[model samples]
Structures are given as structure tokens and as C-alpha cells.
Target: MKKNIYLDFAYFIILASTFGAVLVLGAVVAPVVFHTDVITVNLLIDPYNAGIIMGEIFHRFSYWIYFVAIYVIAYEAMAYKMGQRDAIGFASAFVVVCTSLLFSAIYVPKILSMQALGVEATQSDTFENIHIASEIDFKILALALIVLFIRRLLILRVPSK
Candidate 1:
């Protein structure tokens, strides 16, 4: 990409991630953090009871996918800055989206099953998992961004007068 296009690409990547991440917050992740509807859980974190809460959590991922969105987008900008596109740049974005999709696939049916079970995990555990996953994904995004930024700074040319 051209020098300025690099800037455009960076904007594209970060903005996309932010747009997606913020939407996720609006649509699901943030709302659930504050949700009033509650449930109870039992020993062993049984799938049956855990399903409904899981369902809501799963549903919320649409918004959360943006967690990675921001990182990837920012890296695109950095990639342009450095004049390079390496595996790290691509993998960072890829992992977040792929993991989100993977979690959704498993979480959907599991959540539904909880309805029939008449019980659920303790709210503590449920919330804990949510918090942990949210942080982990966001951290991954941050790390990716840092790597790209550092790489850009390292490789960029200093124009001589």
C-alpha cells in the first residue's frame, strides 16, 4: 500500500474494529454485564442448567467480535506504516474472529439445553467466565496492536534533509 494508503488501511482496520467492538458493547456484552434477569447454578457446572445464561452470553458475542476488530484494523494501519504484512498482523485479527465464531458454535445449543434442566451455574461463576473471556479477547487485541505499532516504528525511514 502507498504511504498514505497505509494510513487509510490503518484507519480502516482500527475503525472497523472500534465500530464492531462498540456495537458489541451496545448490543450484548455491556447489557449482560448489567442484566437483571438471573439464574442459579449447581455443582460441576453442568451443561443443562448452564445453558440459558450461556445462550444470552452466546447471543452477546455478535457485539464482542469487535474486540478483535479494533486490533486487526489498527495493525492494518501499522502495516502500512512499516511497509510490511507479516503473519503476526494477520493472525492477530484471525484468532479473535475465529475464536468468537468457535465459541458461538458450541455455546448456542449448550445454552438452550439449560432451559430443560431447570438450573444453572451460580451467577458468580457465570459472570466470572464472562469477565475472563472478555478480558482475554481484548488483551489479545491490544497485544496485536502493540506488535504492529512497534514493528512500524522500527522499520520506518527517517527522511534526511
Candidate 2:
């Protein structure tokens, strides 16, 4: 029981931190990176350069996402083996894992490859569609993380006896 308690705490902390990172990157870092003119008085980063910068940011973040996905899967599997299963919790965890993998493995690599092809490729319709899809995937990923966090919190809550 003590071990379970510690594991639960660790799981919550990891989930919360990952959730916060997702929010901060999407809401804060992306905006600042893409729109340097918003904060600069005399400097303006070109859109191509901004895309490169953002690509690098996501590239680094992809590793974190991979780690989080593995942790989430391992934790959820352990919980299930311990017979502490909830359908919604499992579903949310699945979404979290799938989206995390999709973003880190598929989308990030594709985006980087298109970026390597240069600005013209990124500006094309194909890149635009992929970028839009990635944005939607990211939003879904965020939602899944929050849902998993709340569900796990509720599941881990111990009622007063």
C-alpha cells in the first residue's frame, strides 16, 4: 500500500508536469517564437526562420513526449494489473498514449522533413494540411492529458471512513 501511494504520487506529478509543459509550449512559447515582432522594438524574425526555430523546439519536446507516453503506459498497465481499473481512465490513458506517440513519432518527423526541404515546401498546400492536422492532434493531446489527469486524481482519491 505504501508503495502504491508513492507510485500514485509520482504518476500525478509526472502527468501534471507534462500537462503544464504542453500548455506552456502551445500557448506561450509558440506565440513568442512565431511572432517575435510582438515583443521586439526593432527586430523581426522572418517566418521561415521562425518555422525553423519552432521546428527545433518541437523536436526537443518530442523526446519528452516519448518519455511521458512510456510512463503513462507503464503506470496504467500496472494499475490495471492491480485491479484498479476504470473504463474512462483507461480510455483517456489510451488517448494520451496514442496522441503522444502520433505527435512525437509521426507528425514531428514529417514536419521536420518538410522543413528540411526548405521554406517553399513548408509554404505549400501539403505542408499546410499536415500542419493543420498536427495542430488538431496537439489540441486533442492536451485534452486527453487533462482528462487523464483529472480521472487519475479522482480514482486515487481516498474517501473519509
Top lDDT model: 2
User: What is the C-alpha local distance difference test score of each model?
Assistant: 0.49, 0.89
- Per-residue lDDT for 1-161 in model 2, tens only? 23377878888898889889989989999899889998898999998899899989999999999999999999999988877788999999999999999999998899999999998999999999988888888989899989998998887784423
TM-score of 1: 0.39
lDDT of model 1 at position 73: 56
Model 1 residue runs over 4 Å out of place are 1-54, 57-60, 63-83, 112-116, 120-161
How close is every model to the real structure, measured as TM-score?
Answer: 0.39, 0.94
Instruction: Mark the 10 consecutive residues where model 2 has the least summed lDDT.
Output: 152-161
